[model samples]
Target: MGEIWIIGATGRAGRNISAGLRAGGHRIVLVGRNAQRLAEAAATIEASGGVPPRTLVTDDPLAEIAAGRPDVVVNTVGPFGTTTVPTAQACVVAGSHYVDLANEFQPVRSLLEMDSAARAAGSTLVTGAGFGTLANEALVYELCAGRPSPIRVRVAAMPVVDGLGPAVLASVVDAAATGGLIYRDGRLVRTRLGAHLRRIPLPDGTTRATVAVPTGELEAALRGSGAGDVIATSSEVPTGRMARAALPIVGAILRVEALRRTVIRLIDRWQLTPPATPGEVSWAYASAEWEGGETRQAWLQTGEGYAFTSRVAAMVAARLAEGDARPGAFTPGALFGADLARSAGATITLDSTTKDLR
Candidate 1:
């Protein structure tokens, strides 16, 4: 097994992914800002009967990564809106395959913009190695492939299993910073995050307000999957009486920079974003509407959130590193075929609602 570096190792997703890889007998080099945290993550893996991976602590990120030269690097960094290109740049120079749980689209666009350099370095760059884009688009493709129709992909996140944590909060902040982007006019388009609230019915026969969040990988997926339109979102409907009353006020609070800062600071101070006990949750689905043909959909639901996505990314990285796969810049959606995406254990729902073209 070659040296595999796990950046942001202390992160929930990182630790979980690293643990899974270690258990699979791969050598891991854990990297993180906090030495103590990295040690704990390594120990946790070891305690779980996994091979304890080597660890590295760094205050200066890119330089440290440059010196490591691992076979592959799995990035668990969040809020990709504020990106440091050197991280990806150095990985390419180091001849390391790059994978990231990048939920934000702008940085991914920027990273893909470096196709020339990445290919020149003979490095593989795969982003949205997480649940956000790859799983969604992959499943959608599985359902709608070979069927001709303008499709719409929509996702509603339920706070269960791993629940929403700070990383998710950071993701929200990143989306806010960039407003939102969607597939419109047969191209990528931007809109406000809180704008365009639409009510979507859940499986439980209840409805919720869904708002677009661009920090997700949906736009890149729209282009990648060749879908007419793709909309990624979070459920913003008030859950309870108190939440219902607080809806407008909560949006107002998030809008104020100071309030947003205070809320995030409080979460940090309390470590409120760390995942609690994970439950069965998901990041999957594809809804298709057709004019005169069968409309199809696919769904991918994981029993666990951080753990599943992490393990998936780690396995993908290992494949790319160990002569198991090819080297090139790509997204997970672009990595495998429709069948492979389904075998990856994401729940796919295929809907065929057609209007007779009589």
Candidate 2:
């Protein structure tokens, strides 16, 4: 069995991913900021017939993690706003395959910044093993199938419209407040927030919304897979009547460090939480034009973005343990085709002819 190390084991996604690994018969080591949470997570993994992992909690997290020597590292840590690079480095030193549920582009850039180092270490690094990156990258790959020319693609995600977690909220705020990475016209462009918005139909046929978020995968995929013109959307601050009302003020409020802290506190108190269970469902769509004047549509409508991502991480890890994977810092779409990814468990649907948009 492969030795799996899950960092941030105290969080919701980490617990579920640990269980998923346990069910698959991998030895699990739970890592958390607190000793008690790590111990608790280890107990649950053991109860599920998994060999309980050694817990590592210390002030020096990176050094502690490097010593573990795990076979695979699954990090469910959030606010990966920072800390991604060092974590990946620890895995590299340990000679382990590294993966994370990172949804933001900033951390992804930071984590993969060590491409040459990771290659030298013979470690395969995977990011956004979570929903946004997982779904969008996989969907874009499928959308380009059967196309002979440059393809224009758009991608987005809408969590069930209620609200989101604090980490998620912080990310949204960061995206808006910082106006992250963007690429266009064959050049890397970093623009301010809400530069563009479009009306895209949901699976329910209601036109929701779409905004651009930074994407490294799209750039990598375009270069690696011969796709052209990828218009990727990152996670956006929720917009609607309520958002339109509050965002300008929120933007102004978030400018002041004190006011921003207060806003986050109030949002947490309101507690607008998602489900406690692991299977919170999310939907994603990708579309593009192919040869012979045809449009192809492919989508991943799956349960709990994080849960789905965890499984993807497990599958990638199992392949590594089985010695069947290629090594390098490559996007998921570059590593596996749309067909393979779909068979792996994404509810991937592809259609060459689409009247749906009409």
Candidate 3:
């Protein structure tokens, strides 16, 4: 089997993915800056009856990737706005397949723009290989499978994570710094952060509130459904009226480079207490409206958010390592289709009366 290298192996997502890959009988190398933490993570995997993984201690992971050229590289670092391009470029140069858990707009868009380069290099690059992008993008693909391009599309990501690490919080801050974005008439348009608030009907018949945010799901939905107008909302963001009103101002303030950096540094140091898990079920919802009053909607249901993310990232990396993916840059759903979500333990429901698609 080809060797898989996991960057940020000391982090939660990285550790989980490394363990998962190991359990699948794949060779994995754990890379991180802190030798002790990397060893600790590796030891935990070893304790689980898996072969002890090789540990690479390095602050310059990109340089290592460029020189060593592992068969596949899994990046769990964030905010991916800074990590994604450099790491992915290194992988492309080394002809190594790459996967990441990025869901932010700019990084996802920037990575997709490298599709031609990746294809030319014969390197497969999969971004947004986590709950946020794949879950919703799969629904959009299923909802619009055999139809003409939808006139409008909306996707909502409502993940129920057990807890969050500091890196997750930092990514949230980075995303807020990017302001708001949507697709209007097939063109990317800027709008106020938290601009459109909607109460989404859930499969369980309850309504959950979501607000517009500049997530990668926006781009994924646009491309998946071929919709001229698209908006991506999330239950992760503040949806209350007061919070909604303040989002634009907060977004504007964070857009200042220095302030954004400072806020991220403070967030790292604060070491927030993990919040209570929201609920047992996480959901991704999508609704498409075509010309002449035709509409279709769908939902994807899964377990805890982080567990699903770890499974998705590990599965993508494993497939890439095994030569199951094409040589190009893509979001997970676009590359492997909606079955990728099903393989990662998500069930899709096309409508109220329809049976779940396993």
Clashes of 1: 15
* Candidate with more favorable, higher TM-score: 1 or 3: 3
- TM-score against truth, every candidate: 0.81, 0.80, 0.97
- Best candidate per lDDT, number? 3
Winning model by TM-score: 3
Q: In the order shown, what is each candidate's alpha-carbon RMSD?
A: 4.1, 4.1, 2.9
For model 3, what is the error of residue 198's alpha carbon versus the real structure, in angstroms, after optimal superposition?
A: 0.6
> What is the Å distance of residue 338 in model 2 from its true position?
2.7
- For model 2, where is the 10-residue window of minimal lDDT? 272-281
Residue 303 error, candidate 2, Å = 2.3
lDDT score at residue 175, model 2, on the 0-100 scale: 42
Model 1, 1-358: lDDT tens per residue? 6778888788777877787778778888898889898888888888877456789888766787688788888877765544425677888888877888776767777777766888888888877676666666676566656756454555444323445556656655545556556776467786654544555544445555555666445655565556566676654233444544454445555668777777666766675653454345554545555544555544565655555567568768777767665556677777665444455565555545453211
Encode model 2's per-residue lDDT on 31-119: one tens digit a residue: 77788878887787777664566777766667766776777777665556645677888888888887776666667767656678888
Clashes of each: 15, 2, 0
